[model samples]
Target chain A: MSDTLDAALRLMRAQAALVRRFDARLGGLHGVSLADFTLLLRLAQAPGGRMRRVDLAEALGLTASGVTRALAPLERIGLVSREPDARDARVAYASLTGTGRERLPEMLATAEETADELFAAPAWGERDVPVLAGLLTRLGGTGLRS
Target chain B: MSDTLDAALRLMRAQAALVRRFDARLGGLHGVSLADFTLLLRLAQAPGGRMRRVDLAEALGLTASGVTRALAPLERIGLVSREPDARDARVAYASLTGTGRERLPEMLATAEETADELFAAPAWGERDVPVLAGLLTRLGGTGLRS
Candidate 1:
């Protein structure tokens, strides 16, 4: 394999490892997966703690139907709610519930703590984090501002 | 969010984007997704072009059940076959068929081309590829030697 192809495979494997780790930690402690945490976090960062379903799908790299399927469980758990746009009945929005807002900080803290440990100590140095983030941004990754 | 957390999110998003791109290209041309390609590639790399089901699961970061499910379609399509251990009835192995070996090169070429284009533009410098691979290695990603 070429170096670029190797790098691509490495990225995929690393991501799988990262998600497994986060899912174990976040799921065990917070009753949420990394995906759910991301959804709630995006809502928290949005202008009104809400987003149009299509926009949220784009942000999360999911199809509209995928977003709907993902939100179904959260909605059932009262972490998110659906709001119909008054002027455009065809438009629907997904907004974080008060429960979601209240619970996000704890989830964010757990995510941060897990992330910190992953980059800490013998494996990674101070400079590696930013370097990796820069490369990932080239691939259209977000969350740099946050 | 801390830079560490941001980096984590970026990794996830970037991986998703990469998968989407690879899926589109590989699926369009080869009728196989990246996961299928990886499975076949790994088998080709093995000493006998085969591996125990459990070992395949570990290498792919999937469960035994997941590996079985993934292999089902490939097996049905004649890209792979299941071999039962002659002495140990309990052991099962997944081996690439002649068809899989013949078609894998084209699929690999497509993956390489997609990966090359992703890192080729104004976004990435020559040093970026090695640098990113090194960082990902710290996270337990492999494929560096290949």
Candidate 2:
């Protein structure tokens, strides 16, 4: 394989491994999967603490059905609430509940810890994280949120 | 969030987006999911083109059940076969079939093309790939194979 392709495969595999680790850690500690945490994080950042389901799907790179599936557990736990858009009844939005906002910091902390552990290896220097993040952001284009 | 944590999240989200794209394209063009392609790639690289199910699980960062589930379709399609170990009756190994070997190049080619398209953006220069791959390798440890 070409060097570029080889590098891409490595990146993909590494990310997969890291995600599995994060999911296990986050789920065991906080009862939230990585996907759930991501959804909550996005909702926490949205204006008025709410986002249309379609936009959530787009932002998360998930299909409409996927977004619905990911939201079900959160809704069940009262972490999120579904509301019809005031301007358009056909449109639904997912809003973060007070409990969800309260719980978000702990999840973010866990995610941050997981990230620190992954990058704590001696092989990764101080500058690597930012450099890598920039490349990933460029490669991902608008798919990755700030 | 701290810079390291932010970088990690970006990497995770970017990889997720890329994998989804790969799965869609590979599934549409070659009838193989990205996970399946990874499995086949691992088997192809194993000695004698075979590996224990447990090892496959470890290598893929999947549970034993997850490995079993992923293998079912590949086995049904004659891409893999189960063999009882001579020394351990309880252990079964997954061996790649001739048909699987025949079909692997096409899947790999598709993956390569997908990688090319993703990195073709102006933001990624040729030098960036090795540097990014090196960082990912460090983060991933031995979990990521060549």
Candidate 3:
């Protein structure tokens, strides 16, 4: 493999491992999957803690149907609510409820803890974080916007 | 979010974007998804170009049933075959066929090109490649063993 391909393979493998770790940790601690946490994080940062379904789909890299399916559980648990857009009846927004805001801090804490453990591994030191983050942000597009 | 969590989130987003891009390119050019490419890569590197079903599942971070479901199409296309283990009738290995070997180079080329485009972005200088790879290897256990 070319050097570039070699690096790409390493990146992909690292992602798979980290994702598995994050998913497990987040799910066990917060009762939320990484995907769900991502959605909630995005919602938490949105204006008024609400977003249009289509916008959420785009931001979360989920399809419209995928956004709907993922939101079902959160909505059922009162963490999110479907609110009809007043001016456009056909358009509905997903609004973060008080419960979701309440749950987010704990979930965010778990995410931070997971990060600390993973990055604190002997293989990585303090200096490496920014380099990794910069490369990922460039590759990921939209930077840290999500 | 803490700096660590912010980095982690960026990494996750990058993985999602790259995976989507790779899946689209691989599927379009080779009639294989990124997950399928990963499986084939693992099989090709395994001893005798084969691996047990359970091993495949673990390496791919997929469940046993997920591996089975993913393999059915490859088996149908004659790119992969199920081989019974002589010592254990209950054990079966997934092996790459000659045709699969013939097809691998082209698919690999596509992956390389995808990596080139992604890494060539101005955000990643030549020096950043090794740093990124090293950090990812540390973060992603087993490194680039796949």
Compare the candidates by TM-score and give the number of the best one. Answer: 1
Worst lDDT run of 10 residues, candidate 3 chain A, spans A137-146
Candidate 3 lDDT over A1-146, as tens digits, reads 77777777777777777778888988898788888998999999999999999899889877889999999999998889999998999788999999999999999989989889888857677778887887777788652232
B53-117 per-residue lDDT for model 3 (tens digits): 99998787777899999999999999999999999998999999999999998998998898888
lDDT of 1 by residue, B13-109 (tens): 9888888889899999989999999999999999889999988988887888999999999999999999999999998999999999899999999
**TM-score per candidate, chains pooled:** 0.94, 0.90, 0.92
Worst 10 residues of 2 chain B by lDDT: B137-146
In model 2, which runs have C-alpha deviations exceeding 4 angstroms?
Answer: A141-146, B143-146
Candidates sorted by TM-score, best first: 1, 3, 2
Which candidate comes out best when scored by lDDT? 1
Cα RMSD of all models vs. native, in order, equals 3.6, 3.0, 3.0
Fraction of the true interface contacts (Cα pairs closer than 8 Å across chains) found in each model: 0.83, 0.64, 0.80
Clashing pairs in 2: none
Model 2 Cα lDDT, one tens digit per residue, A1-146? 66666777777778777777888989999998888998999999999989999999988877789999999989999999999977898899999999999999999999989888888758778888899998888766454332
Tens digit per residue, CA lDDT, model 2, B1-146: 87877887788777777777788888999899888998999999999999999999888777789999999999999999999999999899999999999999999999889888877758778788888888888766454332
Q: How is the predicted docking of candidate 2 categorized under the CAPRI scheme?
A: medium
